[model samples]
Target: TAAPGPQLFLSLCLSRLKFPSDLDELRELAETLKFYKQEHYGYVLLLYCSAYLYKQSFAIPGSSLLNMLAGAIFGPWEGLFLACLLTTSGSTFCFLLSRAFGKQYVVHFFPEKVALLQRKAEENRSSLFFFLLFLRFFPMTPNWFLNITCPVLNIPMPIFFSSVFIGLIPYNFICVRTGSILSEISSLDDIFSWGTLAQLLAIALVALLPGALIKRYGHAHLKVDGLDGDGRDQAGRHRKRR
Candidate 1:
């Protein structure tokens, strides 16, 4: 079994919001957010909270909920862009946070999982870019660890960002589309959260598949190199024909 993504998503989602028994509290919280004056701050804070939960096994829950809220709060294009920004911005925060702490921190927060991740990173050091691409594509790999380890491993930010942006496109589109529909649908059925989640996962596979195939088939055709003519060779070190 691939595991039921919906049940997993729902279980993860509900786990985060251990709400009050009273509907009044719910209403109050929702109203406060709706009327909150510092909209951007709240938005960023929401993202920051997501970053805080980075160590949690199932984090898609928070990110997904935030997108729906972003649509409601910011509306359409602005909301869409803001959602994406929050995601990446939160990721940046997690990256730096984890980097500062190092592997010991990862082991503390996520012993079993982070160990697996560290092993994977070591295995993919030879294909650093593709390794990053794979992680960004599926997102099971905690991005927090990636951000922290990248600098430690001397992986350039340019390579990281290129991989992040390209590999994240499908996920971004999924969130954006979900937000757009959420703007129109004010109810659970209309929200289509379950369906949208499934669709997005499927779309993720669909989007990543082509790229994977192309890379697998055409890796030789694509060469990654530094600006120097001899990529691995040090040009500045050359003492011209002495």
Candidate 2:
């Protein structure tokens, strides 16, 4: 029999691969993929990027595993850069896909969430970018939810891309760095411990501060809808007699 071509070799490799569901499985998967990467560097890179983008662009979960795989194959700095770049690119693709085709479905399925986000967006319109950064930095926030609903919230594309790219640096760094020391990890909790959560929460709060200040102090000088001469919202004031 002739030697298998790169495609056939890749197919055989993928057939043995499964998405890791736990620490041991993740370690095994990492080792297997690392060997393949050594043997077929270009094909492995393409495969990894495609998988990452597919999950992100379609809002599928399980990015943590991919980040670790990147670190195992490419080392810390390279993996971090690749993870960050792919994340931004994939998220922007999601944003565009949602804008073009998923809007109606998103609105119909999550009407209340859409309405809530719209109100929040209006409330933070002055410091919208900071508000977005806050959302991205907040660990409890569901990024997939934001990705799908952002278009309906009328968030500008530039702001969306920049926030996703810059605001997620810490998060991506944590994952990729953890991947560098994967052999030492015993559980998922090791990747995001209480201390890590606290740090992320602190960053989120700091990101929110600028938006809070703008909402408090900048409203008076800006032209705001449904606000009166005193800068109090019109809804709070009693109507004048005709």
Candidate 3:
């Protein structure tokens, strides 16, 4: 016979577990889950982390919903911390997976995109970490695309992890904070208002500025191997090196 404790837990989860599709549904689901979390904190935490990592590792969409859910259940600061940690860890898993198995497929299916990203990466190689942070900070940038392509671009794991962890903080904070006030929010649009977008854009610009300066002014001082005068590599004799 099944253990009563495990059986009860599974039954309870099955009865209440659901994914919210809209703002109304999200509010309802959050309320339900928050109550359940109070009674089964450990189980709820495990379930949330598992679902979050799964979505992140697989490049699934809808993380915004999960972020809000975390806030509703865990409150703002805790939720933000959890979201950032999961985002970085899950993105790292995706990056490693892409490196191991998806490289050829990504290159074959998105040849032009891969080529464009490669050029951009090379152009900012001197300040590649800041460039990555800029991409993460920009709300419009597709993070899933970056997660899968970073390995192909030969971006180091440490830089990729740090950029994701730090760069997505503002975005995550917004989602978590909105979640904490779930009862007051009427629409998803409110979470990402024009003001929020402008702030994200401003942060992205700031992140890119360091890279721009490094590329323009620090080149003459940086000693890179296989580079000739004017900072152009021997392989790309005419192209300016980063």
Candidate 4:
């Protein structure tokens, strides 16, 4: 069973003193952020950027919270741009770090998943761009999991970065838009209403279209290449038999 809201709130607040669990606290934060933005704009920008990168690179929590804050601070479009840029940069850092230090340890821990991902990588090497984009778009895999495992699976850097940047746009825009309206929100329910979910689902469907098309069309070339090799082997074997 789930804990009571107050109990969960208390536990979360105790663990992270700055985590805003209620609308009142979020409103307060918004006001404070406005003052800081007016007073110490450059310094605050640097701090926010550094903190965002550090959290993502180290696999820490608070990215969603930061995205919300970005919407509140920078407004929707600017916040979305900044969030996407930082997310891609931070994920790239994590990817490179995992390749160097954590790949072996991560592979040891998640052997089956790693093997499955590697097999998928081999099978989709030609259309890996779309595959990675779909993976990034959906929540089937966690970002941290992908960051570490992609290196082990030998996915190239360009594909990984491109997917992260493009795939994050829809969800990032949602969170940022929520932030832009944070002051008017009365409860969590308001933020994730049915309307919001439908919009997100529509966006997710759009994101998947490219991957579906690639799967449908990209296999023909691979099949033709395989057939050519098979024909050569058949002719060689017939010559030997004769």
Candidate 5:
């Protein structure tokens, strides 16, 4: 067996690529993987994979493994950047796609979930990016539901992308670091070791720190200083808030 798993994955993820209906191309791709497992090139592949997955269906299964692969192939820095960028881009693409597709699409694809979206819509409706990030954070919720409905409901794109990109940083960092660790270890058992889990947890916290800071700062700054319905600070010079 040539071990073309990643190659097949790479090809499959590209929405633009036309896979043969016969699925025979997968065999050749697999065979080719046995030989083309270049470290540098693989890093690039991982980035493409992450982004493409986001673009195609927002299904980033095995994201930890992919991130670990990134660390293994790119050795951390470049790998981290690639993983984060692609993940963010993919997420943003879905948010935009929601705008174009309409409510029926969301209903069909995400029929099972739609409850708390109203609260979220009210809260982050004003801020797409943060709302998406908040969605990404405590997410057992249906993503596509939010994506499609956001636009129809009149949410702006800037807020959606910004929140998603920033909010998702913690999770993405954890996934990427996991991939790096996988690259480091010799077997699957190592992946279950306490150290790996600890490392991922640490990275997740680190990534979240900035978002927390921003949140705190925003809350601190957003106070209207008892200006009634809005406008003007304590002294009354017209204090506009976020």
Candidate 6:
């Protein structure tokens, strides 16, 4: 008998690469998994979770497909829960790894940005939670970059974890639910329609508002204090009305 591990791993990678686009093929794959679901549901879940974690830890690019599979296989609520769990755990692992060993590489690749971002993160440590929420919710912000940068920026662990856990819920909800209706999707673009984009952008904007307002207010207050100082100080006021 031939050892089947390599073949199985290759097939898994190929299937992931061919995801949603090859609906018919995915349907067949799903049916095969369904047989396993019948015989050993626990095994299926373990494989799925491990694969998700592996992809995240390695910076692989097929998580969106896995998100959909979560819904299609486990149903919306279960899929949503699993996706959130895997995303948080996997992202945290990546963050810690980057913190441990990614500084020199990031500095080499993005010399200017690394120092500037580190300074800004240190200056606005108190507001990192909102900034993180905005980044996580905003579609344009890449999760992999955030994962690498969060630790590099020295963002607190609690804020980073909480932002990911909470900020990702809305988008995860959309993705996991989309999985349930994968049969109707003709292309991956359908996963994120304009309306959906608007919703995510709106959430990101809301998350960003407090930080923006605070920054604006601080600047304005500084300007006002500077203008006041130009006129007179407490001792000057006591000396004369001029």
In candidate 1, position 55 carries an lDDT of: 24
- 10 residues in a row with least lDDT, candidate 1: 231-240
- lDDT, each prediction: 0.50, 0.72, 0.73, 0.69, 0.52, 0.65
> Is candidate 2 or 4 superior in TM-score?
2
Number of the top lDDT candidate? 3
Structural similarity to truth (TM-score) of each candidate: 0.51, 0.73, 0.73, 0.69, 0.56, 0.66
- As for model 1, its CA RMSD to the true structure in angstroms is 14.8
Clash statistics: count for each candidate: 0, 0, 0, 0, 13, 0
Q: Give the winner by TM-score: 1 or 5.
A: 5
Q: Which stretches of candidate 2 lie over 4 Å from their true place?
A: 1-8, 184-242
Better of 1 and 4 by lDDT: 4
- State the lDDT of candidate 3 residue by residue for 1-242, as single tens digits: 32235457678668966667777787887766666666677777898899899989988777889898888889877998999999899999999999999999778765666666677789779888877776665432378878988899999999999998987776777777667767445688855778556645664665566556644543454322222222222213311231
RMSD of each candidate? 14.8, 10.4, 9.6, 13.2, 12.1, 13.9
Q: Stretches of candidate 4 above 4 Å error? A: 1-25, 184-242
Reference-based lDDT, residue 6, model 6: 40
Tens-digit per-residue lDDT, 1-242, candidate 1: 23334444346445643332343443333333344424334443554345434522222334555555555445546655765665665555555555566646545544444444445556567777776776666444444445554545556666766776566656655655555554455577754578656755765775777567645633453232221133112211221221
User: 1 or 6, which is superior by lDDT?
Assistant: 6
Candidate 3 weakest ten by summed lDDT:
231-240
Q: Candidate 2 has which clashing residue pairs, if any?
A: none
| Candidate 5 residue-pair clash tally | 13
lDDT tens digits, residue span 74-191, model 6: 8778999999999988889988888899967756755544555565555556666765665565533357656777777878888888888887776667667666566334587965
Model 6: runs farther than 4 Å from truth? 1-26, 183-242
